[model samples]
Target chain A: MTYCVGLFLDDGLVMLADTRTNAGVDNISSFAKLQVFSTPGDRMIATMTAGSLAVSQAVMNLIQEGVQDPETGETATIYTVPSMFRAASLVGEAVRQVYRTHGKAMQEHGLSFDVSILLGGQLHGRTVRLFQIYSAGNFIEATGDTPFLQIGEHKYGKPILDRAVTSETNLIDGIKLALISMDSTLRSNLSVGLPMDLLVYRKDHLEGPSLRRITEDDEYFLMLRKRWSEAISEAHRQIPQPDWGF
Target chain B: MTYCVGLFLDDGLVMLADTRTNAGVDNISSFAKLQVFSTPGDRMIATMTAGSLAVSQAVMNLIQEGVQDPETGETATIYTVPSMFRAASLVGEAVRQVYRTHGKAMQEHGLSFDVSILLGGQLHGRTVRLFQIYSAGNFIEATGDTPFLQIGEHKYGKPILDRAVTSETNLIDGIKLALISMDSTLRSNLSVGLPMDLLVYRKDHLEGPSLRRITEDDEYFLMLRKRWSEAISEAHRQIPQPDWGF
Candidate 1:
């Protein structure tokens, strides 16, 4: 299982994903799940995927290779898409194409062709957008009322996002909340492990200095995890105890 | 869906369960999921269930009616059980019987005959035990190393237990942590709602004065919910921020 979260705030987008992948309990491994596509000053796109590693890799490859735009008769890739929505559509098409090519063989072996992607970014002149793309190649955009999207092992980390995130949140708070949420998931589930990938997209900056790979040695994350646990324990102690007789 | 947790401690047992039941989003209603049986100074057993309403109800009925023990050829029921183990066996046997009677018909209608129960308590001469009974009637006990068990919509509430619970935890602290865990589930899941039922069993006290039904008007719960949220936000503020330039 994987855990990926995308936050859409007024300032821009904050995306995070864990790198753990496993075929079974004994075959655990880590692989980068976050993908970045950017043509400086033109557009910047970030996608984090969860589900079948094969299918997600295939879709990413197809997107990188580009496809013919049905309307313009020209190949449209993540770089060349005129809008965030079209870039999302291009990703969706890539998914469908991969499914058409590999879905049947996977079913023959009783495996699912499951894959879900959190897509967030902007085109130079367009406003930033966030979308959750499903396995069927369809997608839904996040709205201000529900401005965050999560995929895979999501429930454990969701309450924090539900309570702390909002459209008006700045990129810094967004990243903090995302890390706290990820910390909660990592503590509860073995399927989701360490070595996380984080990216913060500033509103108008098309690129540079916005990505970090967090491993066991990352001092900030280590401190955040320790402090957050202490905070939760402190919070637990601060709650008023029920005055019941027995 | 339901959210129930059982904690086994050196001092006793603490069990908490939400009563909300739903066939779908529109068909939600409240039904008590926690059942308690006590034979004064002899023994006490509590069973909390999650899954198909019909299957659980039937299992409860069969346990109440009694069954012949295959090993001794004597009738066994929760009240007559010699130890906590036998009481759990009785509940497990009841589950198997209910499945034998209704499993196929439910499957024919494309529904699962699924039900899981958390049983916890003690007999006067025996140590306290907690068991999580599966749909097949097989069960696993909570040990000193892992002192808590949860069922149904469990993930959202698990991190707290993972971090805070242990065999040496006192009864009051156990109950507090259980409530905090349940509060987390209640906030994130619509399927698990208010009017929760909580039961605390002190070792060797076959007994009374330790159960309460919490409702929307419950003052302690309201305060805990408010304070916990604030504590989390405060903790968030106290964590060190990433020193990145973008």
Candidate 2:
């Protein structure tokens, strides 16, 4: 299991994802889940995927190929899309294509062709947007009321987001809340591990990777871990005791 | 959906459950999920159920009827059981009975007759014990290593228990933490709601309850809600901001 979150805030956007991937408990490996698509000032899109690694890799590979090849006018690629919505559609098409290629073989082996993705970015002239793409190759956009989206082991980390996140939140503060939410889940569940990947997209910047790669030993995450532990214990101590008799 | 938690500590045992029951977003009702059985100084066992409400209700009804009858050769009804382990077994048997009687009928309607229960308390000469009974009538006892157990909508409230609960913690403090855990879930989900029922059990004293019935307008819970919000926000503010551009 993995935990990935994407936030679309008024100031910009924030995305975070864990690096642990496994076929089973003993087969764990560190794999980067965040994929960045950029073309100078034209567009910038970051995708963080969760579920079966095979299907995600197939979809991502098809995307990279489509973007690199400028041949016969085939279905549009992320780089060629004029709008964020079209870019999301392009990603969905790739997912469908990958399913046509791998779904049958996976089913024969009793494995699901499961894959879901968090896609967010900007197209130079338009506003920033975010989407959660399902395995069925369909998607839903994030609205102003619910500015954040999460996948995989989401429940343990959802309460913090429900209470603390809002559309007007700034990028830096959004990252802080995202990390803290992940911190809480990491403490409670062993399936989601460290070495996270995070990116902050400033409003209209069409080039991604503003900031990336949080290693296991990053000082900020370490401080966040220690501080969160202390904060929870401190909060538990501060609540007044209930007055009740036996 | 439901949220119920049971804790076994050196000071005593604490069990809390929300009253909200829903067949979907529309069919909502306040159905008590907790059942208490005590035989004076001999034993005190509390059982909290979650999952298919029909199945759980049937299980509780059976147990309630068993205590009032003499024909059912089940000598191990919770009220008549001699030890905490036997009482837990009785609860497990009740869960299995419900599943046997209702499982197929529910399956015919494309429903799962799932049931999970949290049982905790003590008998005359034993220490407090908490067990999580499964649909199969199998159960596992909580140890000092994992002192608390939760069922249904558990993830939203788990971080607090993971961080703050231990066998050495005091009974009143345990109850407070349990309430806070429930508070977090209540804030994040519509499926879990009030009026909450809480029970505290002393190690050897059986018979009646210690503290119960936390209604919506209860002043103590209201104050707890207000103070906890303040405390958490304060804790967040008190944690110094990251020096690195976060």
Candidate 3:
């Protein structure tokens, strides 16, 4: 299990992912699931992955190596895609390609080909965008109405995002909400552990995203977690108990 | 899909369940998932179920009809259970009996045998107890360390319970937290819908559980939902935005 979230606010994008990965309870390990593809002042694409580590790594490697466009005979990679849409398509094609290669073998071995990705970034003049790519290689973009997308162990962290995030939200608030969301998931699930990767992309700031690797000892996150818990407890405590006269 | 939660507190037990039952998104209806078997001064047992409606209904029926002990040839029903532990065992046995009768047939029909139950109550002269019964006829009791159990669409509602509820929590607060948890699940999941059933049982007050059928128009629930959303938003807003020097 894993948890990765992306917020596409009017101001920019906030993408956060935990580093924990496990084949089973006993075989837990840490791996960086967030990858950044950037060419200063040109394009900055960030992707956070979740699911079977093998499949995710394979898809990432495929995207990095580039894939041939069947009709044009030209290889296009995440770094060279003309638009965010095409970049997403390239990622999807790479996923399909990986599926074509390993999906059958995995099935025979009783392993499901599971993987999902959150891709969010900007390309020079193009507007910032966020997308959630499914294991089927298809994807959906986040719109103004629903400006956030999450990949794994999503339910635990979703309520906060549902309540606190929106397109109109500023970039700073977006980042805060994303972290709060991640904190909720971390507290509720053991499979999603610490050492998180966070990226805050300012809309159209193609130079690059502000990145932070949040570890267990990260002071700000520690404070945020404590404060958020206290806040929630206090919030509920303030609500008068039901006076149903039992 | 359904959402049911049971919180065993020092003051008593709080059990809540949504009434929605769905075969598919298009085929949906409501049925009472929370059932109480009370013999007033003797015993009070409440069971809340989740998963396949058929399986749950079958298990409920078996418990109501009473299962005969194979060794003693004595019939044992929920109401006649000697202790809360025995009541839990009875519920588990009921689940297994239902499985023995329908599990294979459901498998042949390509349906997985799915059902989980939350049973909590007190018997005369016995301590209050809460147990979560699995489909395999196994169950685990809630202790002071973990005083709450949830079944079905549980993830969305679990974090709040984890953060707040405990055996030491008062009954009134337990009720509030349970409703808040249910409210969270309702907001996050479309399959779990309203008109909920809420039961509060004070420890040793075996004169049946105080019950309420919370409809959409229930004034207190409407107010709680509104206040909760506002409180969460306000709580998050009060947290200072991260100054990560983006």
Candidate 4:
């Protein structure tokens, strides 16, 4: 299991992903689920994956190596895609290719070919865009009405995002809200653990994104967790108790 | 679908259940999910149910009528159970009986025998207890360490309960927390809807519990929803944005 969230705001994009992967309770290991493809000023594409590790790795490898268009025999990769929409299509094609290769064998062994991806980034002349791609090679973009997309262990942390986040939010506050959402999921579910991979991409600033690896002892994260907990306690305390006269 | 929660605390018990039942998004209706059986000072028992309406209704009817024990050739119903634990077992037995009668036919029709129940209350001379009964006729109790149990669309409302409610929480505070939890689920899930049933029971009093059917126009609930949203926004505003120099 994994928890990855992406916020496409007015200022930029905030993407976060946990590193934990487990075959079972006893077979847990850490694997970075966020991948970044950059050609400096040309483009910067970030993808966060959740689901079968084998399938995700295969799809990522295919996208990185480039997929050929059957109609034109032309090869295109994430770094070379002309637009954000094309990049999303490239990722979706890579997923479909992987499914064609392994879907049947996996189903024969009683495994479902489950995978999902969050693709968000920008090209030099294109606008910053975010999308959530499904196992069927279909995808949906994040719009102004819904500026955030999440994959894996999503429900536990959703209410906070639903209540607090919007497209007009600032980049720094977007990061804060994403981390807070991640914190809720980490506390409630043991399957999603740290260290985490975070990327902050400023819209139209194609020089590359600011990236950080958040570990267990990160001071700012620890403070945020503590302060958020305290703030919630205080907030609830302020609400008058129901006067049902029970 | 339904959303129901039960809190077992030092002061007593707080139980809540939503009334929405839907076969699909287009077919939605309200049906009471909470049922109470009390003999004034003798005992007071409450049951909140979720899952297949047909299955839940059948089990409820079985418990209301009496289920006969094979070993002693004796009949026992929820109202006649000797202790709270026995009452839980009676509900579980009713569920199993329903399965025995309908499980095969439902499975043949590509339907599941799905149902879950939350039973909480006290007998005249016994201790107060809360049990979550499953479709298999198995159940688990809520302990002092983990004093609350939820069923049906539970994840969206879980974090607040995990952080706030405890065995030592006062009855009034317990009611407040439960309502807040319900509010979260209501906001996030369309399957769980309005006209909720709430019951509050005081330990050892057993003189019948305070029962309320909260309609959409309920004043306290409306105020709580508005205030809670404001409190959350204000709480998040106080947290410092990440200083990672992005």
DockQ, per model, reads: 0.75, 0.63, 0.84, 0.77
Candidates by DockQ, descending order: 3, 4, 1, 2
Candidate 4 lDDT (Cα, 0 to 1): 0.91
How close is chain B to the truth by TM-score, in each candidate?
0.97, 0.92, 0.97, 0.98
Summarize candidate 2's per-residue lDDT along B87-133 as a digit string, tens digits: 66777777777776778888899997688989888887777788998
- Point out the higher-scoring one by DockQ: 2 or 4: 4
Which one is best on lDDT?
4
What lDDT does each candidate get? Answer: 0.88, 0.83, 0.90, 0.91
lDDT of 1 by residue, A1-246 (tens): 999999999999999999999999999999999999988888889999999999999998888899766677788778777898998899998898888899999999999989999999987878999999999999999999998999999998998887788899889889999998998999999899889999999988875329999898888888888888878777777776679874
A best-first ranking of the candidates according to their lDDT comes to 4, 3, 1, 2
Error of 1 at A55 (Å): 0.3
Ranked by lDDT, the better of candidates 2 and 3 is: 3
Per residue, candidate 3 scores C-alpha lDDT tens digits across B1-246 of 899999988889999999999888899999999999999999999899999999989889888889876667788988777888878888888888888898999999999998999998888898999999998989999998998989999999998998988788888888889999999898889889999999999988877889999999988899988989999888877887777798
State which candidate has the highest DockQ: 3
Looking at model 4, how many pairs of residues clash?
0
What class would a CAPRI assessor give candidate 2's docking? medium
**In model 3, how large is the Cα lDDT of residue A98?**
89
Candidate 4 residue runs with Cα over 4 Å from true position: none
Q: For model 2, name the residue pairs that clash.
A: none
- List where candidate 1 sits over 4 angstroms from the true fold: A69-74
Interface Cα RMSD per model, in Å? 1.2, 1.7, 0.9, 1.0
